[model samples]
Target: MSLARRHREYIQSLTAASAPAMDGGLAPAAAFDAAAGHAPSPAGTISTAAHTINLRLQHDLRRLKEIRSVANKIAVKQELIGEYDAWVAGLLEAGRTAPRGTLAPTGADEVLPTIMVWAIDTGDWRYALALAGHVLRHDVALPARYQRDAATLIVEEVAEAALRAQAANNAFPLDVLEQVEALVDGVDMHDEVRAKLLKAIGTELARGVDAADAGDARRLASAAIDRLTAAQTLHDRVGVKTQIKGLEKALAALPAPEPTDPNTTAAPPQT
Candidate 1:
């Protein structure tokens, strides 16, 4: 049977069971009279049953609201995933057409130069310099078939330029430093080319030390130390002993700046 018809039949059975009993050989009016004083009439009983069904219907409506809330959240999540998929497709397309090894160019070049002209633009300098460094490093990783020596030189030049720009603007140096370290680590250079890259790194480190601001000096020094350590580890792992010596020599040549004292008393109180 249909669900609604079955429900109606069930309700009819319950109503029949709850009906007031008749007296012996009684007419409908007599039955009503007999039950009137002690038992509810059919109309009152049916009204109570209807009220109960209404209460259950109201409860079902509340549950429906909760279900709808969960469904709305799922719909929103699906939309977000769709948007992300579209964005990834666009990025892959751009990467396909980009100059071999170069990533998408930034819109901030002119803005960065303008900000650099204004000495008070502290926030923009660090963000712009880091962004520029990221783009340049991507260029070094282009998939074009090139000789190892040429690629190594190109990476080293880009790294040095990025480091210099970061130093110039008193920018947070970590991003540029990490990029340079990656270039050094990933480049497959022969002995002569590796030595040249190491020399370039040494020059960059020296410039960083000489030009680093008071706030950034410690961070730059720490990053330089880490980069040198990483380069040594990479060399050992790759069995490239030729570059390891040059990297070691570069590490040794870096000046050890004196440690800053955190607590120094300059004033004496007289009684």
Candidate 2:
């Protein structure tokens, strides 16, 4: 059989095997209360709760790995895209059963985000997009500390992936960049963190452009700088002003650009 057909069969097999095992019952309410520190419990009970949480986390992770394997294979075959979407949907459903809130089983927070990114990386845009939306909704419902941290991490991962795509000269880098930018813009964040992240993205873009055409590099770099500057100005204008002044002084110390004379036929001066 062709590789695509084989991959589809493999995905089918994986899905059949990944149905959550029906053997285990939900932990007792007392277990959750102990885990969340609402009731004082002995170390032994807490350890038991931890072990249970770990087992559930492991099952979820295994399913994610299998789904990701299928997704990766499907990404290379246009005909198998639907298969990929189905697997992504299955994985997302498994992720949903994990605990949330103070009583959430340990490690659920970290694992959910990872599963989301696996979908994102494997070209399962619909699921990835849904995961992003789900996270935003969760952020609104949950306390700021958990919600903000999760949202920020997702934004960072998406933005970093976009930068990597740009560096590799991928045709789809612009789309990824725009998606990440939209996600970042949709959220509420502290000014300082936002400025730092935007500046980091700009630096990455500038570096990528260094090996590209001069005009293109300049345009990208200028755009990056503008994003950083804008972010900084919004909440920390004084700090940004000082930083720009310092940068200007440093730039002024550099030699001026050599004038190009097209009529003279002489080579422009090298840096």
Candidate 3:
């Protein structure tokens, strides 16, 4: 279903408008009234609707924290991602309709970036990359609890996931890794994190060597070696030395290209 439509439905599922207001307590009816009363301004102001959404977001965040504290398994946390899907979709809808460059601070500012992380945890690469584009383009700030900036978080998180997938013999898309590299291009991050990215890319490239033709195998091996070597240079302990050596050996095993005859004359173009 469309996110915008889902958002409207989700909001309707909250407390009814006729509910009596509570003193210094959450008043869903008042929140709804405020949302209906105030339209978002063009000057990056947080609308009443966004404020109301933030209240719900805070409750979800608290629940998430409680779950995370007791949950030790990655699988358990991955399963919890679905619970936040509607809220994430709502944030995306709001952001899409906001004026250009109007991404101001809000109580729910952490929602989208946090969902991006969850997307990666669940192996939802397309969703993660889509959120990455929005976060980077709008310059969204991550919550204070996070130690890294958006670019660093994205690079490190995706790189780590790719490396883990490789270790487990799972199929991680090479184009997804390449797209990530392009997304964070020119953004400075830790050398080791960058090295990990290169390692993932090079390893994925090397995987095709067995099925490629002789010439293609040579080309792939060369490219892999270049990337792995650069990764090694960035971090001596990046764990790519063995991989680099393997690619180098593969490239050495390829037969040299046959040279053209120096004395051959060019044929005239066919009529």
TM-score-based ranking, best first? 3, 2, 1
lDDT of 1 by residue, 127-148 (tens): 3343334334444232222233
Q: What Cα-based lDDT does every candidate model obtain?
A: 0.38, 0.47, 0.72
Worst 10 residues of 3 by lDDT: 15-24
lDDT of 3 by residue, 32-80 (tens): 3344554433332344655666676677667666665433434654766
lDDT of 2 by residue, 63-96 (tens): 5456646554445333323433432343345334
Best by lDDT: 3
Q: Which stretches of candidate 3 lie over 4 Å from their true place?
A: 1-48, 68-102, 260-271
Query: Candidate 1's error at 242, in angstroms?
Result: 20
lDDT preference between candidates 2 and 3, better one? 3
* Backbone clash pairs in model 2 (N, Cα, C under 3 Å; residues 3+ apart or in different chains), count: 0
Candidates 2 and 3 compared: the better one by TM-score is 3
- Candidate ranking under lDDT, highest first, comes to 3, 2, 1
| Cα RMSD to the true fold for all candidates | 27.8, 15.4, 7.7
List pairs with backbone clashes in candidate 3: none
